[model samples]
Target: MSQSDAARWEARYQAGTAAYAAQPSAFVLDWLPRLPRGRALDVACGLGATAIALAEAGFDVTAVDIAPTALARARTEAERRGVTVDWQCADLSDLRLPPAQYDLIVNIHYVNRDLTAQFAEALRPGGHVLFEQHLRWPTPVDGPGSDHFRLRPGELRHLLWQLDILHYAEGPFDGRDGERLALARAVGLKHH
Candidate 1:
């Protein structure tokens, strides 16, 4: 991530309660029952909602993010929720994910196409990945202003092609704030 981008996110998180909603992504919650309870990674884990949910679900969870302010808020949320989560403040762009170390990886509302291969390699055999991100659309919507962060149509399917796709969908949906958004969601399982 660029220094400017990091600054932008830090400002966004610090400006208001927009980033730390104390609620897990709806996509993660939907697939919670199907996911295995084991070592898990929550990439770009803003406010640790998904990490807390995973920890509550009995997974050993590690949450990573670039913003210290975000991680600090996440830590408070984790403490309040009475769940233990290993929190790391590091730029995902500079970090190397451990290979075959996680049973599941959850990434929501963040986009870094370069991390797709790392995500696959970081998961244990038969491990799962649950990902959701805003998609580029003809109409404007509330999300990252840059096209660089938005996925093109069918792009996510191609990104995770190496994994066994359990579920995949791309279309308009209600966002966290109830606004219509073009989003892509998928669940993939690495082959054992």
Candidate 2:
């Protein structure tokens, strides 16, 4: 994405017309048992749903997003939900992150293939990475947005093959016009 695209997302958040929900994603709730009781990072955390959820689930969470408006909304929701999360406004593409610090790293509904290796490096020994995103589907009509942001078939699982894969799947799922969801979840342990 170009500079203009990032600015557009900021402008959209600033508009405040899009209703940001205060609840967490269902996938996160479903796999709550898999998360470790330690520090976690929520990447591209729009509105802080996943971040807040992690905190409530007893993990120290750092929520990072590019849009200040979105971060503001997330902060408000975290307070309303009576949980604490460290909110950071920074572009992950350029931000320097600590490696091997977190016990869990989460990415939901966001796609940045270039960061796959970086994410793996950021995990501590026995850390798990949970990822979910929309993917390109074989449909007659084209969906919204650029093809660059959408995942191809089996791309997510393939990207993390070097890690210990716990679960993986790609297919159309319910909610929001039957989105094509791809999940590549795994645990990676550092050498002791």
Candidate 3:
């Protein structure tokens, strides 16, 4: 992401258009008990819902986002919830992660197909990746205009093909915001 893009996201956060659920999404919560508790990374962690939830669930967490304002808010919430998280601000477009460093990785909403490959590199042999995003089906109603930002049918599965896809779904889902959307979700586990 460019400085201009960062500035745009910063402005969005400042304008309060970046609001996200304070609680972690149900999909994420569902996989909590099934995942190993260890080093975790929350990619594009907007309000730190997943990050904080992981912390509370006894996982050491590091979260990243592009906007400082959003990170600040996430930090405050984490502290308020009595959880500690290492938060970093970085462009997801140019994201890189240390090899075999995480036991769990959660990415919700935000889409950066390029980063999917890195998830495998960042996870331990038994680590997992949980991802969900609006799909480009019947056209997006209120989302990025570019198909590049939306997942095409089976694209996510193809992206995580290297990993064992333990869970996968694609269809209309009632979003936490009460909007119905075509969505795709993947939960991949690394066995190597």
Candidate 4:
């Protein structure tokens, strides 16, 4: 991603017109009951919507993002919601997270292929991972240039095949911009 890209996202968050939806991602909500009660990490956590949701659900959440402005918004939201979360203002791609430190890792609407293995390795025993992102498709659907950031067919599942996949889905969805949602929703026990 370019500096401009990061700046653009920061600007969108600073605009603060509810850039983040009040609700958590559908995949996270769907898999909430099955999630182990422990520390969770929200990668590329823009504005802390998912992080706040996880905290509300009794998970010790660490939300990481590159933009301090965005983190500020997230902090404010957490304060307003009366829940606490560790908001780390760092680029996930470069940050070093402790191994096997989280029981759950959630990456929604963000795809960082290079970080997939690292994320999976960070899960503790019987940990779960909830992933949801746009898919690359030939026909335009969600918005212009979505294909650029979206995943290709079977990309997420294939990348996460090492984990015990509990759910997988890929298709066009009406919600969240005309984009296709691909989820590699998984529950796997780390081999000790």
- Find the candidate with the highest TM-score and give its number: 1
Candidate 1 global CA lDDT score: 0.88
Q: Candidate 2 vs candidate 4: which has greater lDDT?
A: 4
TM-score of each: 0.95, 0.86, 0.94, 0.87
Query: What CA RMSD would you report for each candidate?
Result: 1.3, 2.7, 1.5, 2.5
lDDT of each: 0.88, 0.74, 0.87, 0.76
Clashes of 2: 0
Model 3 residue 164 lDDT? 94
List residue ranges in candidate 2 displaced over 4 A. Answer: 17-22, 140-144, 176-192
Estimate the overall C-alpha local distance difference test score of candidate 2: 0.74
Q: Which candidate tops lDDT?
A: 1
> What tens-digit string does per-residue lDDT give for candidate 3 at 1-192?
789988998998899886764568689999899887899999988878889999999999999999999899999999998999999999998877889999999998888877887888888999999998878988456656777778988889998988999999998887677866788999999996
Stretches of candidate 4 off by over 4 Å are: 17-22, 143-146, 176-192
Q: RMSD (Cα, Å) of candidate 2?
A: 2.7
lDDT, model 2, position 183: 34
- The collision pairs in model 4 are 136-151, 142-178
What's model 3's lDDT at 160? 90
